[model samples]
Target: MNPPNSLNPALVALDSLPLVVSLAAPIGVAYSGGADSCALLLAAAERWPGQVRALHVHHGLQPAADDFVRVCESVCTGLTLPLQVLQVDARHGPGDSPEDAARRARYTALAAAARQLRLQAVLLGQHADDQVETLLLALSRGAGLPGLSAMAPRFERDGVTFYRPLLQTPAAALRDWLVRQQIAFVDDPSNSDERYTRNRIRARLLPALDSAFPRFRQTFARSARHAAQAQELLVEVAQEDLDRVGNPPAIQALQGLSAARQANVLRHWLLRAHQATPSTAQLAQLLGQIAACTTRGHQLHLKVGSGHITRAGAVLRYTPLGDKAG
Candidate 1:
């Protein structure tokens, strides 16, 4: 983690946000040596000197991974911030993509580092442009409200808070700031690979949209904000209904709600019961079956990855499926 050459606008703007106070325990910044993440490290170190540490995960996919780690370590040394370099093998599973596998490995390394360092929060460099891309990807996949909401500024998982203070900043601004500071960063060649949807969105779709509509990023950001607000309200109402209905709702009680609300309630139930969210198609199929079933004892099984829903005896129960069964 290194401080900027001078107080940049991003730092000034971030400082205006409500400061999250943490004790002397170090704050982890997921430094990738990229412009965006390097900017985040700079801001975190500038704002909370001596309390910020940089953790860089080396995915070992690139030939220059060691060089990237060295750059991260050098930056941290310059700023007098502690650094942790983790090496991870991002091998894809049977049906998994390399990008997805790398992301999972990156987050796993970050979470483990946070626990080892006892950090309160891990700061990420996800900015407004990334948010727009995420929202667009979710929309392309016909995702529901929650998926359309994209990423949150702050969230807790595995006893550590993930913070995205730069969510309101654009990647261009961060890159410009880095250039102004004469900071050299690596540009991953994988970003140009069109095999990934995000790269296609970034290189082709977003640039074309920016040419046609200058404020496309802001528009998508605003849409995500509105969708997030609506999703929050829906979750509140669904939780209230869940409390009233007890553990498993009676078929009569479930059928009393409107189709949309029933889907919302079931979605919430599935999320809480399985500790993982269902894909858009899975949710739609589950809701479709729930609505189409007329007989009282009709059983509908909705499979969500490692979890499944079994509707038997007029009670919808979520159970771990296949090898996950306990």
Candidate 2:
């Protein structure tokens, strides 16, 4: 591997990051031993020196998991930075996808590690291409503003602040920089397997998009930013509406608002309060049921994500299906 050097232009390009002016250190880098993450680890170590730590999660889903950790050990040893490795079960649940399961496990592990280390923040290495891929995936899945907004540059999960410092950087730039610097990093074979939607998009859709729109990454990122801004406003409005409507959302008060506002507020209530998301059909049905509830005799019982939305007296209530009471 190339030796550590000055903060050159190449490094600076990888540095347009975090969307936050200041972050509390000692910061942790989520190191997966991939090109994108390796570039981030190197940059963070260079910039922060003693203030940096590497956090690697070993999802024992593949044979190379141990190899990845070994690479992380080598890199962290060379940088004189502490490395924390967390072994995680990334197996998907009955209704969950493998990618989602792995991602959830990875984030949980990262947050736990950061908390244990007393690190103020964790930096992720998802780049511009990954952002574009997320946007495309959302589009393909008919996702709303939340998904269309794609990945947030900064977010809080499990009470830990996470930053995607390389969100605006290009994938090619990271790999190219790694090549130039002779940085050693592993390539996850799953990334090339086209069975996954993201891998398929990366293999097929991205090249086509690039050919058609040379600056698709920047433009797509701009669109995502707009979506995020709009979603933020919607959230503000939803919070106001929810406060007016009550947490359980009184049926009479909900009926006072327009269908669009009702949809907005209800969606916000389910997602924010219950961590539940209803499908479009399910939400629409719930709205129809609400509209039909002109008498006390009318009932509301609809199945939502892993939960059931039911009428508890005059207000709506969501209970996990797992609860015997639900």
Candidate 3:
């Protein structure tokens, strides 16, 4: 496959980097008909041609959702790229917000599409600005090192490697590229809605920060990079501890480490064992309760979805709590 030399200057620089070269498989770009994703699709088509296909997930949240899909199809057709459009039911569960439900459903559909198509990797158009916003949101939630680390360039989930090749590209640069190419795209109005925390950050907090500090985005991106490196080291240390202690002995293994190490180990163990990530608040409360309990026989449980952590003898075990007997 030819390299993407004709892409925007910023993206051209990213494509030359080692990370993109080392990706495990050919890239499948997720196209949403937004400027960011459209630029990525075009760049991928030029760079990887036969290796890139456009995948679109239609959540049907907006009235023009189908039209957006049509635009994506047209773009792909013009570029002679294969296109897959998936319709997902994103209705929220009781007490669950729409955004959360929609995102979960979207990823589920994308993963299914990837598996069925036998695709090894999926590319997203998440850019440097998005990473900065995510890092700030994580900090606002009092997230520890891992959360602050934000998105990685590549991550494996559900047997597919998700690649964010444009992580270092700025949103403005993508917009400029699209304009230069005379590419038409849809602007999702939901992005401007202030009700969502992410929207609020992008609309309010980020602008204020940008006005006061012109390089706020770059600063946050750098901070996230530093946090990612630190988290990597912490994860190595936590893995060593896990190897030494095996499993928590009556949750006592948690109390044995320094507070930072305890959090790291707990996060790592939960991720490895159950593939679950507890909220920052939930993790803090769970750790505190686990440490303070005096009665050896008292069972300490923290429930997430159908999963629960229970203290058994001297070990804390994660188990899927039984469903209601029907």
Candidate 4:
């Protein structure tokens, strides 16, 4: 389905939120009592009543987290919807991106909660501004097609489906809608801190986008969709390439393909077979090394992610750091 293409407050029609949430029934709304989520929750409850579940993940990263939970509880109680608050440890270690760590933790918590609660799908409140920030961040970091594509509207993980029905809606529309309805929502303090790249992008870059391109959120999102489509096609090609190379691909056979195809298939293999993803530079370097492998006696070893891409004779294998090469 094409994402809704406007951030104009009018786009948040009375029925729009309910319309989006109805598509994925028996869904758990990832509620945080923020404007975006509050609007979503209100609409879902009004539309489906007993069908909607409010799932709140308490990251415990901020002092205001407890307050957020209280707000979510109050809203859920008022709406007569069941609320489940899952507190999680979302600390980022040295050298780890806090955003990445928190995201991983959030998803983990969601999956675990979904399993425990036996929910079919989880809905998120991420909006068009988030999409723009993601795309811009991907550009800033020189990420590849996969990164540029950003978040998927719907994806399945750990036997549960995740839906982002508001991806096409802008944050402004959500806030305005809530204001008109006189619904109170808390602004996350951490979101204003520019120490994080996403926060900086949201605060500084978003306004600049508004001035330069009045509807840049939708435009940026369209570009992201294009990138996502392109990435899907590449993934298909990589899958086909993998089928030809056989499992634990033979080094000789892989070296026969072009550099780009080699990179594609290797990326597919690493992610699927080893649960590891590498940077573009790392993939290119690894491809160069594969090209340099001219003899059976030549050793094949390079660090890729938290593992080493090692050659066990003709077969390329991934061994986690410090694991036996077998």
- Best by the lDDT measure: 2
Q: Encode model 4's per-residue lDDT on 1-326: one tens digit a residue.
A: 22353233423433454334444446688898888778777766665668888999999998899999898988888888999999899999999989989999999989888888777677788888888898999899888898899888878888888877777888977887676666678899988999989999988889988999998988888989999999999999999999988789888889889888999999999999889998877888888888888987888788999999877888888998878885
The global C-alpha lDDT for each of the candidates, from Candidate 1 onward, is 0.81, 0.88, 0.78, 0.83
Model 3 weakest lDDT span, ten residues long? 1-10
List, residue by residue over 187-227, the lDDT tens digit for candidate 1.
77777889889989999888898889988877888888899
**CA RMSD, predictions in order:** 3.3, 2.9, 4.4, 4.1
Sorted on TM-score, best first, the list reads 2, 4, 1, 3
Q: State every prediction's TM-score relative to the real structure.
A: 0.89, 0.93, 0.84, 0.91
List model 2 lDDT by residue over 1-326, tens digit each.
43455343325754666433244658888999999888888888777767888899999999989999999899889888898889999999898999999999999999989898888889898999999999999999999999999999889988999988666778987787677777789999889999999999999999999999999999999999999999999999999999999998999999999999999999999999999998999999999999999999898889999899989889998999878544
Q: How far is 170's C-alpha from truth in model 2 (Å)?
A: 0.5
Question: Which is the winner by TM-score between candidate 2 and candidate 3?
Answer: 2
Off by over 4 Å in 2: 1-10, 13-25, 322-326
Q: How many Å off is the CA of 242 in candidate 2?
A: 0.8
What ranking of all candidate models by lDDT puts the best one first? 2, 4, 1, 3
Candidate 1: worst-modelled 10 consecutive residues by lDDT: 1-10
Window of ten residues with lowest summed lDDT in model 2: 1-10
Q: Candidate 1 local accuracy as lDDT?
A: 0.81
